[model samples]
Target: MNDLTINTAIQTALPATFLGRHLIDGNWVEGAETFQRVSPSHDTVVSVSAKGDAAVTADAIAAARKAFDAGVWSRISAKERSAVLLKVADLIEANVERIAVQETLESGKPISQALGEVAGAADLWRYAASLARTSHGDSHNSLGADMLGVVVKDPIGVVSIITPWNFPFWILSQKLPFALAAGCTVVVKPSEMTPSSTVMMGELLIEAGLPAGVCNIVLGHGEPVGSVMSTHADVDMVTFTGSTAVGKMITEASAGTLKKVALELGGKNPQVIMPDADLENAADAATFGIYFNVGQCCNSSSRIIVHESIAEGFVARVVALSRKVKFGDPMDPDTQVGAIVTAEHQTKIDGYVKEAVAAGAKLELGGGALSVEGLGPQFYQPTVISNVTPDMPIAREEVFGPVLTVLTFKTLEEAIALTNDSEYGLSAGIWSNDIHTCLEYARHAKAGTVWTNTWMDGYPELAFGGVKQSGQGREIGRYGYDEFLEVKSLVMRVGRDSRKPWVKASA
Candidate 1:
């Protein structure tokens, strides 16, 4: 690793020259146009990224298709592919600091959190590597003595992956590594707002011996680039992580080609605090759920559904805890909350809070924009709102920021009702000591992932996804790998006297 130190003063340490290139067909190529990437913390241009148009996106798709059809990557042995993925994981571990710094600079997440996400990304790669070697087909002995039957899992060809701005590298790891492990070629489009880290990822994959045309990166807005990737006939699968609205768009666009789509979209996750629960611990868990990653996570517990008996005290505890959260320079290791992704996003979060307050939700704490000493006005104070009704927009919609809305439930049935009442069924949590109550609620909640006494806990071995409008299909674990694969069954006659009476009967 180079002994390059990032300047803590300006927070602009990345090389200006490494920015405006797209990785296509295993080569760094300049784009037809370029756009400046402004840091959310300081509002300064951090890098100029390549702007991929429809034609450029088509080129990337063609490259991936060629690689897949050529069988350069798809026909390779599973163990060999696993070896390559393991090397990629090794490379990522070696450059954790560098990648984390770039991620923090581009996405405005705290440096400590960024480092943790980078390490998580490396672990995801290693897990995908393990899956690659272990994944296998099946043979049936029950087919009878005259015939043999086999079922095989094969790669689904070129995959187009679109990742979001928040947790850029981490989300990409959830999709890309597994796709590659399954022997699929890929064309990726990271969010234009934070493409720097992903662009560097393309370089790192190449260094780790990913074959040319096997992995391609296109940097641009969703307009021509994302649209092309979704509708392109050559692309076999599209896995996206972002808003539910955009996930719907991708699904509609993919209808033209009937491509396989796995969408990990938005959420209005609820944290239900039962009357028997520990108020202090529940408050702390709620704070972590809605504030971590600046509450930009899809599975963020934005809604706090508390039993009426404990609602008031729990709300007060959450408000007091919100005050202790530090918001400042993203590069600082002590900063718990960092700047929002952009001024536009900050405005949207503010608008939600304002609308909620106007609609009779009481603002218990932090309700407006925050001004850090030297950082620009992109940070918003961690906010807590109480007296939120189920019908209120703040309670129903996704705020996508460090804003938590508190609602009270009179009974266990009411709590479960409130939890299931959403267009999103991504994630939900129950804070209770009663095993039977927790289990009942978990079974009834409409979410894909339910945490009994925890929030946002995940493992690569377990499947993750959402139900209803939260989008379709699963990610991570064997399910995530299966998303990039297709199953095929084969049958063959084995008996020497297998030429039976079919022709005689026809005659």
Candidate 2:
């Protein structure tokens, strides 16, 4: 039996079902159909959201297109756009408690984690505000004695932004604010499971004084909502954060129009440990890495490639830490871990653990579901699998749970090989006391971000994305802000007679 405290006391009063509507052209509109949201943890209704169809998506696309073409938002001054962004950031801070409560209830994550994600998202908006003012293009004055060349950066018109349920508010901030910073109007589709936070963001956006039709929220599934958003001719680009399979579908959907696509998808990230490293700190980090957000994050270090000399001790340390992590009511402030998002997801996680054990891997810890005293049985225990080979699915696939797999490596070369063996190339962590080891991994690891002596520490200034099948394009920093923009070159002559023409009049 797990010794972690299962807090049975409920402090916060659950609110009545929230009404989720579509935000189109500065108006809150109702859909033809509405779907109810049942909290996975409490097994209670949390929201009733408008169900969007293809027609609704088309309307949203039209609104964004019209808004962009009319220059209602796209043609605004950078200072004006930046000021609105700052206000949005301020409003986010003001509404953190309200948003966090709903996020925890709908998403089945701990209130603490939800609070952190929502609070931290404001920084992204603030940083994007700064980016709007500093963004610029290039010019060439020495093209010729009487000629000049200039390049201008402009918004890429309408964008379709689709976010996943795991990190709804935080992920939306990553894409939406950057697009706004580039002066691009957008239509966003949040995962049906967690639509309230995005709707909440729409409320914040409007209160920040964003112009009509600048940002629209459409609630529904991927089919009619996200599908239309991806394939519509009026949408100039699609920015998505979800599974790699859906990302692939978006890539194919946008192919006809050749619209720009930016995706942050799945990851089977690994963290490498050296014998000379600080083993205690590394073990603690590994424990936190796999369990944070219940390991549902794309950046989670699901597997750890450890040097053979210290493998056994490191595994034991992590297992002990896992045993002590609190897993219970999400509303409790002291709970370290919370419920899984859904029963289906919990079953998938258990299947991976069972398959790994059947494939000759040793189960050092949990491998099944847990029923908290006051909640439904949607919680998966912190699991650890050892004696895992690089070829095993448990070691290679993106399990996306609070489960950690251990693969042993005898040398630095072997560790690096094991890290790069997977199809994913998103993020990697290296824990080593030797400068040479960390630097070598930094140079060789085929991931977008490399964390040396740390894991998953991100900054708004640093770009985030992946290589190979993980995804295309970055999500934050200067590069992320630039992704929503288009560049054009202009050549000018000082006088009418100064320009040379290649075409002859006789022709």
Candidate 3:
């Protein structure tokens, strides 16, 4: 692209605005308070949004409940629903550059990754549109001459979605499209830090012809807005993506109403490097696994469990890769690593590093805090720590930053034990040349997802989620739609006569 094109692409066509207010009943209304979105790279206020509290969040829940139960949006055919979603996808694609820039400025992610996420999110919408028609229920053959049995899936009505700041558009796309495809009305509570894109998404959905209230955006903190949405009596389901602590809170809040809850929480995933693995490939994979998106990913491989034979070599290679990573100017396409989300989060990450060091963990590469040259107070620089024990805070805690801890094991059993030591069971990666070892780890690893010979990869077709503390329920596949749906089993009497008398219960 030319210089003019490059400059123009990075700038948003839409004028910068406060974007304050929650989108309820098809219009924006200010809440009692407001929250500021600060640029993590430069520590400057980027935008602000109305801090939706319990009352305002209740309004959104009521609107979604009304849309699902009374409005025409949920009454449409699957094909018609798919058409609307496809339109939303198209509109997002048309404004990809603008949305990408907005996301980068707010979330402190690299502009290239942000653009890719925007495109990927748009594709997710289109994919869900196609899946709408494909995911109908199934019928079973009657066991006897007089009976017919079928299993049907139905939308669970109003859904409350609470998303995180990292990959703002992508996380929403993951939940919202599937919920829409399932014929459910949605109320989204985006992270206070990156609420701008979601608010803009409201306008795009409107332009895409989605009926008002079919999809709504509420901006605010988790305590009030998120808690209210999770506990709202009218909301039939709640889905959240964030830390384990917050995920637990959502589950607790939703318990009173018995809302269906789907959580994608934190992870302390392990990257196992076997003795026979390609050192170069493993090193590169390990680096990208932890450092990509500044290690803010739930499935990031923060723990490197390597065989003792190759520990030093692998650590050296990882340290080399860490040093070479470009960390600055999130808007630059060449920037391989970007800033952490905020100063508070950066401090938290640095604390983890310090605590780990105090606990006898060796800082192999970048450790401590770093401020980008041009940027004011960004958390840049890739970090890699070796000689780390499982007991170290950095090894166990989800720092949610670009910090990696390396540990060594002599035997496969030890490695497996170490990998399963964490409370999280989100995802793990095993790098090995041996087919048996790959299959063994894949079979025995205590994680929701496992990658053999690869790391930190995902697709729309594959399901994503966790098993233990990483959270419950799945997203991004058929399970994603299933999470938003309630299933009913239909059973009919096989014989008209009194041959088989059975007591039946009503659902």
For residues 1-507, write the lDDT of model 3, one tens digit per residue: 010011112322333644667899899787677778777765567787888777778888888888888846777899999999999998998989888887888888888889899988887888889889898787878466776788988888999989999978999999999999999999998888888889888988888888878888888888777878888789899899998988888898889989889999999999899989988998899888887888888878899999998888889898877777767777878876787887788888888888888888887777766655556666645778888888877888898888888999999888899989989999998998999998988889999999998886788878899988999999988878788888898987665754554767666
lDDT of 1 by residue, 1-507 (tens): 011111233343543534758999999989778998788886678878889999999999999999999999999999889999999899898888988887887888888999999988888999999999999899998977888889999999999999999988999999999999999999999999889888878878998899999999999999999999999999999999999999999999999889999999989999999988977788899999999998888989999999898888888888777777767788888777888998888899999999989999898888888767667778888889998988989999998999999999988899999999999999999999999999999999999999989888899998899999898999999988899999999988886755657657554
Looking at model 2, the pairs that clash are none
Give per-residue lDDT, candidate 1, residue 426: 97
In Å, residue 357's CA in model 3 sits off its true spot by 1.6
Instruction: For residues 1-507, write the lDDT of model 2, one tens digit per residue.
Output: 456445553756997789999999999999899998899889999999999999988988899999999998888899999999999999999999899989988988889999999999999999999999999999999978888899999999899999999999999999999999999999999999999999999999999999989999999999889999999999999999999999999999899999999999999999999999999899999999998987888999999999888999999999988888878888888777888888898888899999999999999888888777777888888889999988899888889899999999988888888889989999998999999889998899989999999898998999999998899999999999999999999998875566456876784
Whose lDDT is higher: candidate 1's or candidate 2's? Answer: 2
The deviation in Å at residue 167 for candidate 2 is: 0.6
In terms of lDDT, the best-performing candidate is: 2
Error of 3 at 507 (Å): 36
Ranking by TM-score: 2, 1, 3
Off by over 4 Å in 3: 1-18, 492-507
> Considering lDDT, which of the candidate structures 2 and 3 is the better prediction for this target?
2
What candidate 2 gets wrong by more than 4 Å, as runs, is 4-11, 496-507
Overall lDDT per candidate, in order of appearance = 0.89, 0.91, 0.83
